[model samples]
Target: MKNTIFTITLILVGLIATSCSSDSSDNNLNTAESLQAVTDLALSGTWVISSFIESGTDETDDFTGYVFTFNSDGSLVADNGTMTVSGTWSVTSDDSSDDDDDYDSDDDIDFNIFFAAPPTFEELTEDWDIVSRSASRIELIDISGGNGGTDTLTFEKN
Candidate 1:
């Protein structure tokens, strides 16, 4: 009788542990899905640069006149005068949302940047820290270290 009771207790403990593990995995998946949904909604539209502030500088370059087109197929094209640049972009990772209750605002909308420059059209990509995102606007921090200054670009849907 003692042997039978011990076996039953062990089996019950194993089942409970497995159940808890499965619940955690499900929670992770749901969180990921929620973040992806926001990204997909933000990607497919015409976004005009509402503001561009270069990091470390008090001067803010107003780009309210230009439009940035990001197609659903991951292509990018921007025209701000006679100059036009074409490139491609892909989401490297969906970090988390910018909810005041959950994650820090600074860590919100974090993702990567992929681009193909002119002449060769070779693909070049880098990680960009996204500052904030919504159905109508996206703010990204330029993480590329070069002559290009770090900038915060705010875009609005057109």
Candidate 2:
């Protein structure tokens, strides 16, 4: 009788463990989906350059009064209240190059901005690291510039 009872207890424990594992997997999936949704929503909006820092110097006024519109289809339009320049933008995962397996690291996302227009706007292009992001703001940093200068760009909803 003791042997049978011991067998039943072991089986029950295994079943409970499996159930808990399944729930944890589901929770992880939900978390991933939520994060992606937040990123998408934050990118699809009209933003203005609230702050622009290059090589530790401020250059926010370079884009003053300009509004950048990021469409869901990866198209971007920058309007300086007179003329508009078209471009493309995309957000991608940078996990492949991550040195560590830390899933919560901010360096896991790459915010790429591309433009082909007046030379002035070219400075705003790069595959930047997503330092931070929210519903009303996004902060990006580029540390791989050929000039060995770091660039930080902050955009706030307009």
Candidate 3:
């Protein structure tokens, strides 16, 4: 009788442990999916520079100069001149979603940081705040100077 009781107790403990483990695993998977969804909404493609403007200047140049790719692997290539500069980037958020204005009620959003680039403009090096994001469009603001303007960059999935 003692042996049987010990076996049943052990079995019950094992089952409880297994159940808890599976629940934890499910939570982890959900967290990963949430992160991927946010990244997909933010980064996973090519972004074209629709507009470029300097601070305190009425002059806005519609140059072919632009940034071509920003990858989730922290790699980026920007075409400013004849030269192509490459660097790693990082992303952060004031909260999980940076600013609420950048997303719809159903949208997920995040902020990104750019590092190690050629000194082109103070705006480029500064923290690029994602003002709004959607399936095909992204609005970014240069939070560098209080005078920083917004750029609406559009992309098609390639």
Candidate 4:
């Protein structure tokens, strides 16, 4: 009868909805894994600044031809054809802390760069949030630079 048909239709709709929801969650997991793979491959090579923004101003020209090399041992060397600057570099996942069970790593990755002396690239040394990353490039953002300005840095693998 009509009652049985109505019940069957409702059940079918519920099953379809449940199946779609589960697929989305699986897709999210896959995206996270893909991003992590890209980060691992991108970190060990010579890179150059593709874009640099400080306080809403483009400063990419200042670092033209400068090469930055990153090693697996947390060492970094910046070579500008004339001089070299030594520093350290690292990337931390947002959920790396053991105490934060509710933390989500998909949206909270951070990149750190430290220098011993004055760096040729101003405001480049900071704990920056990874906005986006790929096997050949990484986009970073520092919302707080202690100078009330945002810093954006992008590096492309050479």
Instruction: Estimate the TM-score of every prediction.
Output: 0.56, 0.71, 0.50, 0.66
TM-score of 2: 0.71
Residue range with the least summed lDDT across 10 consecutive positions in model 3: 102-111
lDDT of 3 by residue, 1-158 (tens): 99999999999999999999999887666656655665666476666655555554432243255555777787767666686767655554333444344323223323454546445432355444555556766555543335434433233333
- On the 0 to 100 scale, the lDDT of residue 29 in model 4 is 81
* Candidate 1, 2-91: lDDT as tens digits: 999999999999999999999989767765774576458557677776665555553324344556676667677766677666776655
Clashing residue pairs in candidate 1 (N, C-alpha, C atoms within 3 angstroms):
none
Model 1, 91: alpha-carbon shift in Å?
1.5
Answer with 2 or 4, whichever has the higher lDDT. Answer: 2
Best of the two (1, 2) by lDDT: 2
lDDT of 4 by residue, 1-158 (tens): 99999999999999999999999898678657755564575566789999999889998997788898877788888898898888887765555443222222345455778887665553688877666677788877776525667778999998
Q: After superposition, how far is residue 2 of candidate 1 from its true place, in Å?
A: 16
Best by lDDT: 2
Residue 55 error for model 1, in Å? 2.6
| Candidate 4: pairs in clash | none
Which segments of candidate 1 are over 4 A away from where they belong? Answer: 1-23, 58-64, 80-82, 94-110, 115-126, 142-151
Whole-model Cα lDDT of every candidate shown, in order:
0.58, 0.77, 0.54, 0.74
Highest TM-score model number: 2
